[model samples]
Target: MQHPAVPELAHTHTRPIHWVATATAIAGVVALSSLLQPKPATAAQSATPDAKPAPTTAPSTADVDFPLDCGPEQALVVKKATGDLDGDGTPETVAVVHCDAPMGTPPDGVYVLTHNPGHTHARVVATLIDPKARNTVTGLTVTDGAVLATLLGYSTADVPSCCPDVKDSARWQWKDNTFVRSTPAGARSI
Candidate 1:
Protein backbone atom coordinates (compact mmCIF):
# COMPACT_ATOMS: atom_id res chain seq x y z
CA MET A 1 0.00 0.00 0.00
CA GLN A 2 1.12 3.55 -0.81
CA HIS A 3 2.28 5.68 2.24
CA PRO A 4 0.35 8.78 3.22
CA ALA A 5 1.46 12.26 1.99
CA VAL A 6 3.96 13.01 4.78
CA PRO A 7 6.93 11.02 6.20
CA GLU A 8 7.20 9.98 9.84
CA LEU A 9 10.01 12.55 10.38
CA ALA A 10 7.56 15.35 9.64
CA HIS A 11 5.73 14.68 12.95
CA THR A 12 6.87 16.87 15.92
CA HIS A 13 7.54 15.47 19.40
CA THR A 14 5.62 18.19 21.33
CA ARG A 15 5.49 16.79 24.88
CA PRO A 16 9.22 15.94 25.23
CA ILE A 17 10.22 19.29 23.75
CA HIS A 18 8.05 21.17 26.26
CA TRP A 19 9.40 19.08 29.14
CA VAL A 20 12.98 19.79 28.10
CA ALA A 21 12.32 23.51 27.85
CA THR A 22 10.71 23.64 31.32
CA ALA A 23 13.49 21.66 32.94
CA THR A 24 16.11 23.91 31.31
CA ALA A 25 14.35 27.05 32.57
CA ILE A 26 14.15 25.64 36.13
CA ALA A 27 17.83 24.70 36.10
CA GLY A 28 18.76 28.20 34.88
CA VAL A 29 16.79 29.84 37.70
CA VAL A 30 18.43 27.63 40.32
CA ALA A 31 21.87 28.43 38.95
CA LEU A 32 21.09 32.16 38.97
CA SER A 33 19.91 32.01 42.59
CA SER A 34 23.13 30.39 43.73
CA LEU A 35 25.12 33.18 42.05
CA LEU A 36 23.01 35.91 43.66
CA GLN A 37 23.11 34.50 47.20
CA PRO A 38 25.08 36.54 49.76
CA LYS A 39 28.41 35.08 50.72
CA PRO A 40 29.21 34.48 54.40
CA ALA A 41 32.09 36.35 55.97
CA THR A 42 35.32 34.43 56.60
CA ALA A 43 37.36 34.62 59.83
CA ALA A 44 40.08 36.63 58.11
CA GLN A 45 37.62 39.43 57.31
CA SER A 46 36.30 39.60 60.92
CA ALA A 47 38.86 42.21 61.95
CA THR A 48 37.91 45.65 60.70
CA PRO A 49 40.95 47.23 59.04
CA ASP A 50 39.80 50.84 59.49
CA ALA A 51 38.55 50.40 63.06
CA LYS A 52 39.63 53.04 65.57
CA PRO A 53 41.20 52.25 68.93
CA ALA A 54 38.94 51.97 72.00
CA PRO A 55 38.14 55.24 73.78
CA THR A 56 40.44 55.87 76.79
CA THR A 57 37.85 57.95 78.68
CA ALA A 58 34.21 57.24 79.50
CA PRO A 59 31.58 58.67 77.15
CA SER A 60 30.25 62.16 77.94
CA THR A 61 26.69 60.87 78.03
CA ALA A 62 27.48 58.11 80.53
CA ASP A 63 25.58 59.85 83.30
CA VAL A 64 22.71 60.87 81.03
CA ASP A 65 19.65 58.62 80.77
CA PHE A 66 18.73 59.10 77.16
CA PRO A 67 15.92 57.25 75.42
CA LEU A 68 14.59 57.14 78.97
CA ASP A 69 12.41 54.49 80.64
CA CYS A 70 10.59 51.40 79.49
CA GLY A 71 12.00 48.12 78.24
CA PRO A 72 12.24 46.61 74.74
CA GLU A 73 8.52 45.79 74.81
CA GLN A 74 7.67 49.50 75.08
CA ALA A 75 6.28 50.40 71.70
CA LEU A 76 6.33 54.18 72.24
CA VAL A 77 9.07 56.45 73.60
CA VAL A 78 9.28 60.21 73.78
CA LYS A 79 11.61 60.99 70.87
CA LYS A 80 11.43 64.77 70.64
CA ALA A 81 9.50 66.70 73.25
CA THR A 82 9.08 66.72 77.04
CA GLY A 83 7.56 69.71 78.79
CA ASP A 84 4.35 71.01 80.38
CA LEU A 85 2.11 69.94 77.50
CA ASP A 86 -1.24 70.35 79.25
CA GLY A 87 -0.01 73.27 81.39
CA ASP A 88 -0.47 71.04 84.46
CA GLY A 89 2.97 72.08 85.84
CA THR A 90 4.20 68.47 85.55
CA PRO A 91 6.43 67.78 82.53
CA GLU A 92 4.46 66.08 79.76
CA THR A 93 5.92 64.00 76.93
CA VAL A 94 5.73 64.14 73.12
CA ALA A 95 7.08 61.49 70.78
CA VAL A 96 6.97 59.85 67.35
CA VAL A 97 4.90 56.69 67.59
CA HIS A 98 3.47 54.79 64.63
CA CYS A 99 0.78 52.39 65.85
CA ASP A 100 0.83 50.68 62.46
CA ALA A 101 4.59 50.22 62.36
CA PRO A 102 4.54 46.42 62.62
CA MET A 103 1.16 45.84 60.96
CA GLY A 104 -0.39 48.13 58.35
CA THR A 105 1.18 51.00 56.37
CA PRO A 106 3.90 53.12 58.02
CA PRO A 107 2.47 56.00 60.07
CA ASP A 108 5.29 57.08 62.42
CA GLY A 109 3.52 60.03 64.00
CA VAL A 110 3.68 62.56 66.81
CA TYR A 111 2.07 61.80 70.18
CA VAL A 112 1.52 63.76 73.39
CA LEU A 113 1.60 61.91 76.71
CA THR A 114 0.33 63.57 79.86
CA HIS A 115 1.95 62.52 83.13
CA ASN A 116 -0.15 61.71 86.17
CA PRO A 117 1.18 62.28 89.67
CA GLY A 118 -1.49 60.00 91.17
CA HIS A 119 -0.15 56.98 89.26
CA THR A 120 2.95 55.75 87.40
CA HIS A 121 1.08 55.49 84.13
CA ALA A 122 0.85 58.24 81.50
CA ARG A 123 -2.12 58.92 79.22
CA VAL A 124 -1.96 59.80 75.52
CA VAL A 125 -3.51 63.19 74.87
CA ALA A 126 -2.83 63.63 71.16
CA THR A 127 -1.96 61.22 68.36
CA LEU A 128 -1.16 62.76 64.97
CA ILE A 129 -0.66 59.92 62.51
CA ASP A 130 0.36 61.32 59.10
CA PRO A 131 0.41 58.08 57.14
CA LYS A 132 0.33 59.27 53.51
CA ALA A 133 2.71 62.18 54.18
CA ARG A 134 5.41 62.57 56.84
CA ASN A 135 8.29 60.23 57.73
CA THR A 136 8.92 61.47 61.25
CA VAL A 137 9.06 64.52 63.50
CA THR A 138 12.40 66.25 63.04
CA GLY A 139 11.96 68.70 65.89
CA LEU A 140 9.34 69.78 68.44
CA THR A 141 9.10 73.17 70.15
CA VAL A 142 6.70 74.10 72.97
CA THR A 143 6.30 77.85 72.69
CA ASP A 144 4.01 79.96 74.86
CA GLY A 145 1.85 76.95 75.76
CA ALA A 146 1.62 75.74 72.15
CA VAL A 147 3.45 72.78 70.64
CA LEU A 148 5.00 73.19 67.19
CA ALA A 149 5.96 69.93 65.53
CA THR A 150 8.31 70.08 62.57
CA LEU A 151 7.65 67.09 60.36
CA LEU A 152 9.54 65.93 57.30
CA GLY A 153 7.19 64.93 54.53
CA TYR A 154 8.15 62.80 51.57
CA SER A 155 8.57 64.20 48.07
CA THR A 156 6.72 61.18 46.73
CA ALA A 157 4.78 58.34 48.35
CA ASP A 158 7.05 55.76 46.72
CA VAL A 159 10.10 57.33 48.35
CA PRO A 160 11.79 55.73 51.41
CA SER A 161 11.09 56.84 54.98
CA CYS A 162 14.45 58.54 55.63
CA CYS A 163 14.39 60.90 52.64
CA PRO A 164 11.65 63.51 52.95
CA ASP A 165 11.77 66.73 50.96
CA VAL A 166 8.72 68.62 52.22
CA LYS A 167 8.60 70.19 55.68
CA ASP A 168 5.31 70.53 57.58
CA SER A 169 5.71 72.63 60.70
CA ALA A 170 2.34 72.25 62.36
CA ARG A 171 1.08 73.93 65.53
CA TRP A 172 -1.06 72.29 68.21
CA GLN A 173 -2.33 73.69 71.47
CA TRP A 174 -3.77 72.13 74.61
CA LYS A 175 -7.04 73.96 75.13
CA ASP A 176 -10.12 72.94 77.10
CA ASN A 177 -8.22 69.88 78.38
CA THR A 178 -7.64 68.52 74.84
CA PHE A 179 -5.09 68.76 72.07
CA VAL A 180 -6.27 71.02 69.25
CA ARG A 181 -4.56 71.81 65.98
CA SER A 182 -4.00 75.53 66.01
CA THR A 183 -2.53 75.65 62.49
CA PRO A 184 -3.31 73.07 59.85
CA ALA A 185 -0.16 72.07 57.92
CA GLY A 186 -1.38 69.20 55.86
CA ALA A 187 0.37 67.56 52.93
CA ARG A 188 1.94 69.85 50.38
CA SER A 189 0.37 70.40 46.94
CA ILE A 190 1.44 67.46 44.82
Candidate 2:
Protein backbone atom coordinates (compact mmCIF):
# COMPACT_ATOMS: atom_id res chain seq x y z
CA MET A 1 0.00 0.00 0.00
CA GLN A 2 1.38 3.48 -0.86
CA HIS A 3 1.57 5.79 2.20
CA PRO A 4 1.38 9.57 2.32
CA ALA A 5 4.69 11.42 2.12
CA VAL A 6 3.62 14.25 4.54
CA PRO A 7 5.75 14.19 7.73
CA GLU A 8 2.78 14.85 10.07
CA LEU A 9 0.77 11.85 8.73
CA ALA A 10 3.77 9.48 8.78
CA HIS A 11 4.61 10.19 12.48
CA THR A 12 1.10 10.54 13.89
CA HIS A 13 -0.33 7.36 12.41
CA THR A 14 2.53 5.04 13.62
CA ARG A 15 2.27 5.31 17.50
CA PRO A 16 -0.01 2.90 19.48
CA ILE A 17 -3.11 4.46 21.08
CA HIS A 18 -3.35 1.85 23.90
CA TRP A 19 -0.15 3.00 25.74
CA VAL A 20 -2.07 5.21 28.22
CA ALA A 21 -4.55 2.41 29.04
CA THR A 22 -1.69 -0.12 29.46
CA ALA A 23 0.16 2.21 31.88
CA THR A 24 -3.02 2.67 33.93
CA ALA A 25 -3.56 -1.10 34.13
CA ILE A 26 0.06 -1.65 35.23
CA ALA A 27 -0.30 0.97 37.97
CA GLY A 28 -3.51 -0.70 39.27
CA VAL A 29 -1.83 -4.11 39.34
CA VAL A 30 1.11 -2.75 41.34
CA ALA A 31 -1.20 -1.14 43.90
CA LEU A 32 -3.33 -4.28 44.23
CA SER A 33 -0.26 -6.50 44.69
CA SER A 34 1.10 -4.31 47.47
CA LEU A 35 -2.23 -4.35 49.33
CA LEU A 36 -2.53 -8.15 49.10
CA GLN A 37 0.95 -8.81 50.57
CA PRO A 38 1.17 -9.79 54.25
CA LYS A 39 2.91 -7.48 56.74
CA PRO A 40 6.25 -8.46 58.31
CA ALA A 41 6.21 -9.71 61.92
CA THR A 42 7.01 -7.30 64.77
CA ALA A 43 10.45 -7.54 66.47
CA ALA A 44 9.09 -8.69 69.82
CA GLN A 45 6.94 -11.43 68.29
CA SER A 46 9.76 -12.68 66.07
CA ALA A 47 12.48 -12.77 68.78
CA THR A 48 14.48 -15.98 69.31
CA PRO A 49 12.95 -18.67 71.54
CA ASP A 50 15.87 -18.41 74.02
CA ALA A 51 15.03 -14.74 74.89
CA LYS A 52 14.02 -14.33 78.56
CA PRO A 53 10.51 -13.12 79.43
CA ALA A 54 10.14 -9.50 80.55
CA PRO A 55 10.04 -9.01 84.33
CA THR A 56 6.76 -7.82 85.78
CA THR A 57 6.53 -5.19 88.53
CA ALA A 58 4.25 -5.58 91.51
CA PRO A 59 1.20 -3.35 91.70
CA SER A 60 1.64 -0.25 93.87
CA THR A 61 -0.09 0.03 97.27
CA ALA A 62 -0.32 3.83 97.46
CA ASP A 63 -4.11 4.03 97.70
CA VAL A 64 -4.24 1.93 100.84
CA ASP A 65 -4.23 4.86 103.32
CA PHE A 66 -5.99 8.22 103.49
CA PRO A 67 -4.13 11.51 103.78
CA LEU A 68 -3.78 12.00 107.53
CA ASP A 69 -3.38 15.74 107.43
CA CYS A 70 -5.99 17.55 105.40
CA GLY A 71 -3.71 20.57 105.45
CA PRO A 72 -1.39 20.75 108.50
CA GLU A 73 -3.39 19.22 111.33
CA GLN A 74 -3.02 15.50 112.01
CA ALA A 75 -5.89 12.97 111.95
CA LEU A 76 -7.58 12.55 115.33
CA VAL A 77 -10.02 9.75 114.66
CA VAL A 78 -10.36 7.06 111.97
CA LYS A 79 -13.69 5.27 112.40
CA LYS A 80 -13.81 2.14 110.28
CA ALA A 81 -17.05 1.30 108.50
CA THR A 82 -18.39 -0.15 105.26
CA GLY A 83 -21.05 0.92 102.76
CA ASP A 84 -21.71 0.89 99.04
CA LEU A 85 -21.09 4.51 98.07
CA ASP A 86 -21.80 3.96 94.37
CA GLY A 87 -24.59 1.46 95.01
CA ASP A 88 -22.35 -1.21 93.52
CA GLY A 89 -22.23 -4.77 94.83
CA THR A 90 -18.90 -4.12 96.57
CA PRO A 91 -19.22 -2.42 99.96
CA GLU A 92 -16.39 -0.14 101.07
CA THR A 93 -15.47 0.88 104.58
CA VAL A 94 -15.86 4.57 105.38
CA ALA A 95 -13.19 6.19 107.59
CA VAL A 96 -14.87 8.96 109.63
CA VAL A 97 -11.88 10.68 111.21
CA HIS A 98 -11.71 13.82 113.31
CA CYS A 99 -8.76 16.11 113.05
CA ASP A 100 -7.84 17.55 116.46
CA ALA A 101 -6.75 21.04 115.31
CA PRO A 102 -7.73 23.22 112.42
CA MET A 103 -5.93 22.07 109.31
CA GLY A 104 -3.72 25.16 109.47
CA THR A 105 -4.75 26.79 112.78
CA PRO A 106 -5.01 25.52 116.36
CA PRO A 107 -8.04 23.36 117.40
CA ASP A 108 -7.90 21.52 114.04
CA GLY A 109 -11.38 20.10 113.74
CA VAL A 110 -13.16 17.06 112.35
CA TYR A 111 -12.65 15.56 108.88
CA VAL A 112 -14.16 12.66 106.95
CA LEU A 113 -12.30 9.81 105.21
CA THR A 114 -13.16 7.93 102.03
CA HIS A 115 -11.41 5.27 99.96
CA ASN A 116 -9.72 5.23 96.55
CA PRO A 117 -9.92 1.91 94.72
CA GLY A 118 -7.30 2.69 92.12
CA HIS A 119 -4.61 2.82 94.79
CA THR A 120 -3.24 -0.35 96.34
CA HIS A 121 -3.90 0.87 99.90
CA ALA A 122 -6.68 2.85 101.61
CA ARG A 123 -6.27 6.53 102.44
CA VAL A 124 -8.20 9.51 103.76
CA VAL A 125 -10.25 10.64 100.78
CA ALA A 126 -11.73 13.96 101.85
CA THR A 127 -12.00 16.30 104.80
CA LEU A 128 -15.07 18.34 105.75
CA ILE A 129 -14.66 21.39 107.98
CA ASP A 130 -17.34 22.55 110.44
CA PRO A 131 -20.84 22.56 108.98
CA LYS A 132 -21.72 26.09 110.22
CA ALA A 133 -19.63 27.71 107.51
CA ARG A 134 -20.66 28.02 103.91
CA ASN A 135 -19.63 25.23 101.50
CA THR A 136 -19.30 22.86 104.42
CA VAL A 137 -20.20 19.19 104.73
CA THR A 138 -23.24 19.13 107.06
CA GLY A 139 -23.46 15.38 107.81
CA LEU A 140 -22.93 11.84 106.57
CA THR A 141 -26.19 10.18 105.63
CA VAL A 142 -26.47 6.65 104.19
CA THR A 143 -29.94 5.76 102.94
CA ASP A 144 -31.43 2.64 101.40
CA GLY A 145 -28.82 2.52 98.66
CA ALA A 146 -27.30 6.01 98.55
CA VAL A 147 -24.50 7.46 100.69
CA LEU A 148 -24.50 11.21 101.25
CA ALA A 149 -21.85 13.24 103.10
CA THR A 150 -22.40 16.93 103.72
CA LEU A 151 -19.65 19.46 103.13
CA LEU A 152 -19.20 21.45 106.30
CA GLY A 153 -16.43 23.83 105.24
CA TYR A 154 -13.80 24.27 102.60
CA SER A 155 -10.18 23.65 103.35
CA THR A 156 -7.97 26.46 102.18
CA ALA A 157 -5.24 23.89 101.53
CA ASP A 158 -6.97 20.56 100.89
CA VAL A 159 -9.98 21.31 98.66
CA PRO A 160 -10.70 23.81 95.89
CA SER A 161 -12.78 26.88 96.82
CA CYS A 162 -15.31 26.39 94.01
CA CYS A 163 -16.26 22.92 95.25
CA PRO A 164 -19.74 21.48 96.04
CA ASP A 165 -21.02 23.54 93.13
CA VAL A 166 -24.10 22.33 91.21
CA LYS A 167 -22.09 19.72 89.32
CA ASP A 168 -19.46 18.95 91.97
CA SER A 169 -20.09 17.95 95.60
CA ALA A 170 -17.37 17.04 98.12
CA ARG A 171 -17.91 13.36 98.82
CA TRP A 172 -15.80 10.22 99.30
CA GLN A 173 -15.88 6.55 98.41
CA TRP A 174 -14.27 3.45 99.95
CA LYS A 175 -12.19 1.65 97.39
CA ASP A 176 -9.20 -0.70 97.67
CA ASN A 177 -8.92 -0.02 101.39
CA THR A 178 -8.80 3.76 101.89
CA PHE A 179 -11.06 6.75 101.89
CA VAL A 180 -11.04 8.89 98.77
CA ARG A 181 -12.63 12.11 97.61
CA SER A 182 -16.03 11.53 96.07
CA THR A 183 -17.39 13.62 93.22
CA PRO A 184 -20.52 13.48 91.12
CA ALA A 185 -18.43 11.84 88.43
CA GLY A 186 -17.05 9.26 90.90
CA ALA A 187 -14.61 8.82 93.78
CA ARG A 188 -11.16 10.34 93.24
CA SER A 189 -8.47 8.20 94.89
CA ILE A 190 -6.33 10.42 97.08
Candidate 3:
Protein backbone atom coordinates (compact mmCIF):
# COMPACT_ATOMS: atom_id res chain seq x y z
CA MET A 1 0.00 0.00 0.00
CA GLN A 2 1.57 3.27 -1.13
CA HIS A 3 0.98 6.23 1.25
CA PRO A 4 1.40 9.89 0.56
CA ALA A 5 4.48 11.59 2.14
CA VAL A 6 3.63 14.00 4.90
CA PRO A 7 6.35 16.50 5.95
CA GLU A 8 4.71 17.47 9.31
CA LEU A 9 3.97 13.85 10.37
CA ALA A 10 7.69 12.97 10.22
CA HIS A 11 8.47 15.46 13.06
CA THR A 12 5.51 14.36 15.22
CA HIS A 13 7.51 11.54 16.85
CA THR A 14 10.80 13.45 16.96
CA ARG A 15 13.09 14.41 19.89
CA PRO A 16 10.93 17.41 20.80
CA ILE A 17 7.96 15.19 21.71
CA HIS A 18 10.25 12.83 23.63
CA TRP A 19 11.74 15.75 25.55
CA VAL A 20 8.27 17.10 26.30
CA ALA A 21 7.09 13.67 27.49
CA THR A 22 10.15 13.25 29.73
CA ALA A 23 9.67 16.70 31.20
CA THR A 24 5.98 16.03 31.89
CA ALA A 25 6.78 12.69 33.55
CA ILE A 26 9.43 14.27 35.76
CA ALA A 27 7.07 17.05 36.72
CA GLY A 28 4.34 14.55 37.60
CA VAL A 29 6.70 12.54 39.83
CA VAL A 30 7.85 15.66 41.61
CA ALA A 31 4.28 16.78 42.28
CA LEU A 32 3.27 13.33 43.55
CA SER A 33 6.29 13.17 45.88
CA SER A 34 5.55 16.62 47.24
CA LEU A 35 1.99 15.56 48.07
CA LEU A 36 2.89 12.19 49.67
CA GLN A 37 6.13 13.04 51.48
CA PRO A 38 5.98 14.27 55.06
CA LYS A 39 6.37 17.98 55.42
CA PRO A 40 9.58 19.23 56.91
CA ALA A 41 9.07 20.93 60.25
CA THR A 42 9.37 24.68 60.21
CA ALA A 43 10.69 26.81 63.04
CA ALA A 44 7.22 27.93 64.12
CA GLN A 45 5.74 24.46 63.82
CA SER A 46 8.42 22.78 65.91
CA ALA A 47 9.03 25.60 68.37
CA THR A 48 8.24 24.84 72.03
CA PRO A 49 7.52 27.85 74.18
CA ASP A 50 7.60 25.91 77.46
CA ALA A 51 10.73 23.93 76.65
CA LYS A 52 13.56 24.51 79.08
CA PRO A 53 16.99 24.41 77.50
CA ALA A 54 19.68 22.12 78.87
CA PRO A 55 22.55 23.74 80.72
CA THR A 56 25.40 24.38 78.38
CA THR A 57 27.96 25.05 81.13
CA ALA A 58 28.35 24.21 84.80
CA PRO A 59 26.27 26.39 87.10
CA SER A 60 29.25 26.98 89.37
CA THR A 61 31.33 28.28 86.46
CA ALA A 62 28.78 30.26 84.47
CA ASP A 63 29.28 34.02 84.24
CA VAL A 64 25.81 35.21 85.16
CA ASP A 65 24.39 37.34 87.96
CA PHE A 66 22.51 35.77 90.84
CA PRO A 67 19.36 37.80 90.29
CA LEU A 68 19.41 36.75 86.60
CA ASP A 69 18.95 40.37 85.53
CA CYS A 70 15.55 39.35 84.13
CA GLY A 71 15.17 43.00 83.06
CA PRO A 72 14.12 45.64 85.56
CA GLU A 73 10.60 46.01 84.22
CA GLN A 74 9.67 42.43 85.06
CA ALA A 75 11.50 41.73 88.31
CA LEU A 76 13.15 43.36 91.34
CA VAL A 77 15.61 42.51 94.08
CA VAL A 78 14.35 41.67 97.54
CA LYS A 79 17.35 40.42 99.54
CA LYS A 80 21.07 39.86 99.13
CA ALA A 81 23.85 37.89 100.86
CA THR A 82 27.60 37.57 100.34
CA GLY A 83 29.93 34.73 101.32
CA ASP A 84 31.93 31.77 100.00
CA LEU A 85 29.97 28.51 99.80
CA ASP A 86 31.63 26.80 96.85
CA GLY A 87 35.06 26.34 98.50
CA ASP A 88 36.66 27.91 95.46
CA GLY A 89 38.78 30.39 97.43
CA THR A 90 36.27 33.14 96.67
CA PRO A 91 33.11 34.69 98.06
CA GLU A 92 29.74 34.41 96.33
CA THR A 93 26.79 36.76 96.38
CA VAL A 94 23.34 35.37 97.11
CA ALA A 95 20.25 37.33 96.24
CA VAL A 96 16.49 36.93 96.40
CA VAL A 97 14.68 38.10 93.29
CA HIS A 98 11.02 39.13 93.28
CA CYS A 99 8.82 39.35 90.24
CA ASP A 100 6.53 42.31 89.67
CA ALA A 101 3.04 40.93 89.42
CA PRO A 102 -0.23 42.80 89.84
CA MET A 103 -0.83 41.39 93.32
CA GLY A 104 0.18 41.97 96.92
CA THR A 105 3.73 40.73 97.61
CA PRO A 106 5.15 38.78 94.71
CA PRO A 107 6.94 35.46 95.17
CA ASP A 108 10.70 35.57 95.64
CA GLY A 109 13.59 33.28 94.64
CA VAL A 110 17.22 32.74 95.71
CA TYR A 111 20.39 32.69 93.64
CA VAL A 112 24.15 32.63 94.12
CA LEU A 113 26.60 34.70 92.11
CA THR A 114 30.38 34.73 92.33
CA HIS A 115 32.71 37.65 91.80
CA ASN A 116 34.41 37.50 88.43
CA PRO A 117 38.02 36.40 88.31
CA GLY A 118 39.13 39.93 87.42
CA HIS A 119 36.84 41.55 90.01
CA THR A 120 34.91 43.11 87.16
CA HIS A 121 31.46 41.56 87.70
CA ALA A 122 29.58 38.78 89.46
CA ARG A 123 28.71 35.40 87.97
CA VAL A 124 25.86 33.13 89.08
CA VAL A 125 26.63 29.71 90.54
CA ALA A 126 23.26 28.41 91.65
CA THR A 127 19.60 29.37 91.78
CA LEU A 128 16.58 28.42 93.89
CA ILE A 129 13.76 29.96 91.89
CA ASP A 130 10.26 30.68 93.19
CA PRO A 131 10.74 29.12 96.56
CA LYS A 132 7.34 29.92 97.97
CA ALA A 133 4.38 32.22 97.54
CA ARG A 134 4.63 35.60 99.28
CA ASN A 135 7.97 34.53 100.69
CA THR A 136 11.56 35.73 100.54
CA VAL A 137 14.90 34.86 101.90
CA THR A 138 15.00 36.13 105.46
CA GLY A 139 18.69 35.32 105.89
CA LEU A 140 21.45 33.65 103.94
CA THR A 141 25.02 32.64 104.70
CA VAL A 142 27.76 30.84 102.74
CA THR A 143 30.13 28.88 104.97
CA ASP A 144 31.75 25.44 105.17
CA GLY A 145 31.11 24.95 101.49
CA ALA A 146 27.41 25.21 102.17
CA VAL A 147 24.66 27.72 101.44
CA LEU A 148 22.10 28.14 104.22
CA ALA A 149 19.12 30.01 102.81
CA THR A 150 16.49 30.95 105.35
CA LEU A 151 13.16 31.16 103.58
CA LEU A 152 10.16 32.66 105.35
CA GLY A 153 6.80 31.32 104.29
CA TYR A 154 3.58 33.17 104.96
CA SER A 155 0.41 31.57 106.29
CA THR A 156 -1.88 34.11 104.65
CA ALA A 157 -1.50 36.60 101.86
CA ASP A 158 -2.24 39.53 104.18
CA VAL A 159 0.44 38.68 106.71
CA PRO A 160 3.14 41.08 107.84
CA SER A 161 6.32 41.31 105.83
CA CYS A 162 8.81 40.67 108.60
CA CYS A 163 7.22 37.83 110.56
CA PRO A 164 6.37 34.87 108.38
CA ASP A 165 4.23 32.21 110.08
CA VAL A 166 6.45 29.44 108.82
CA LYS A 167 10.24 29.64 108.72
CA ASP A 168 11.92 27.18 106.38
CA SER A 169 15.55 26.84 105.51
CA ALA A 170 17.26 25.07 102.64
CA ARG A 171 20.89 24.09 102.63
CA TRP A 172 22.80 23.56 99.39
CA GLN A 173 26.25 22.19 98.81
CA TRP A 174 28.18 22.71 95.61
CA LYS A 175 28.91 19.10 94.79
CA ASP A 176 30.95 18.37 91.70
CA ASN A 177 29.33 20.81 89.25
CA THR A 178 25.94 21.57 90.76
CA PHE A 179 24.15 22.50 93.98
CA VAL A 180 22.66 19.72 96.07
CA ARG A 181 20.07 20.58 98.67
CA SER A 182 20.30 18.87 102.03
CA THR A 183 18.22 18.64 105.20
CA PRO A 184 18.11 21.77 107.32
CA ALA A 185 18.36 22.11 111.12
CA GLY A 186 14.86 20.74 111.86
CA ALA A 187 13.74 19.22 108.63
CA ARG A 188 12.75 15.60 107.97
CA SER A 189 12.57 14.45 104.37
CA ILE A 190 10.84 11.28 103.25
lDDT of 2 by residue, 27-120 (tens): 9999999889887767757558885443232222233443444466444543333455544444444444544654432222233333434444
* Better TM-score candidate (1, 3): 3
Model 3 error, position 45 (Å)? 48
Tens-digit lDDT string for candidate 1 (20-84): 99899999999999899887877754548875443332122111222323244334433555666
How close is every model to the real structure, measured as TM-score? 0.45, 0.29, 0.48
lDDT of 3 by residue, 11-71 (tens): 5566877889899999999999888988777775454997544333223423344453344
Model 3, 117: alpha-carbon shift in Å? 5.3
The local distance difference test score of each candidate is 0.58, 0.45, 0.64
Candidate 2 TM-score over all chains jointly: 0.29
Name model 2 segments beyond 4 Å from true: 1-64, 70-73, 78-81, 102-136, 154-190
RMSD of 1: 23.5
lDDT rank, highest first? 3, 1, 2
